[model samples]
Target: MSNDRVGFSQPQPEPDRQALGERLKEAREYMGLKQEDVAKVLGIPRSALSNIEAGVRKVDAIELARLAKLYQRPVAWFTGEDPEATSEVAKEVAHVARAAATLSQQDRQELARFANFLKSRAKAKATPDGR
Candidate 1:
């Protein structure tokens, strides 16, 4: 009855549960979904979802995959295994750039200037001395 094998003897390591929970919470909030809504889709209790987000419960692979699909993100995002997943702003900028590709060069330049103007205005507002 000895089932111990050389390669299978090592136990798997636990994941960073808190980080995973934070990513799940961020993804859910970014998608404007309520815990009850996601729980309904996952066929789990709302309290279970809350526990997952609070890092009090471990998320199984199937649940992670389901949440990734529900949040329009890859499973690696929830696991913190993908660098691109952490850069949501970069993704948004890439999306905007792709959409702008269809416009004329002049229009693109104008759009860039407008974007710069908005950014500078916001930066100025954030400064204490209003530089």
Candidate 2:
């Protein structure tokens, strides 16, 4: 008998290992962490971290959790299941683009400067003694 039962969901596709590795690498870089430091924290060799970043090695669950904690990112982000990857973010991006398009050239330059200031301020906040 064909088991075409209701409520039987199809299996989800496997997460892309290469993409996951790329996200992990990006997070590490964003946190200003070198592979050696991250590997040392994980109690693994630097070469293993390199392999993991190159998508040549699989990260076990425990390691993934540790990496996520160190990187300050959710595991779902590395797995391409980021909660922020939603229509709301797209809408916000679109709104920003539209607003920028309407700005005069000088206003746009001022806006860009303001954005740079905000970025630098955030960086300063992240550093000890406010840079």
Regions of model 2 farther than 4 Å from truth? 1-15, 83-131
State residue 95's C-alpha deviation in candidate 2, in Å.
18
> Given candidate 1, what's the lDDT at residue 42?
94
lDDT of 2 by residue, 1-131 (tens): 45556646433323486677787897787666799999999999998898788776789999999999997667887887776843586457546756885788899899889989999999999999998
Clashes of each: 0, 0
TM-score of each: 0.57, 0.54
Note the Cα lDDT for every prediction shown. Answer: 0.82, 0.79
Decoy 2 TM-score against native: 0.54
lDDT of 1 by residue, 80-124 (tens): 778986688857965786678678889999998999999999999
Worst 10 residues of 2 by lDDT: 6-15
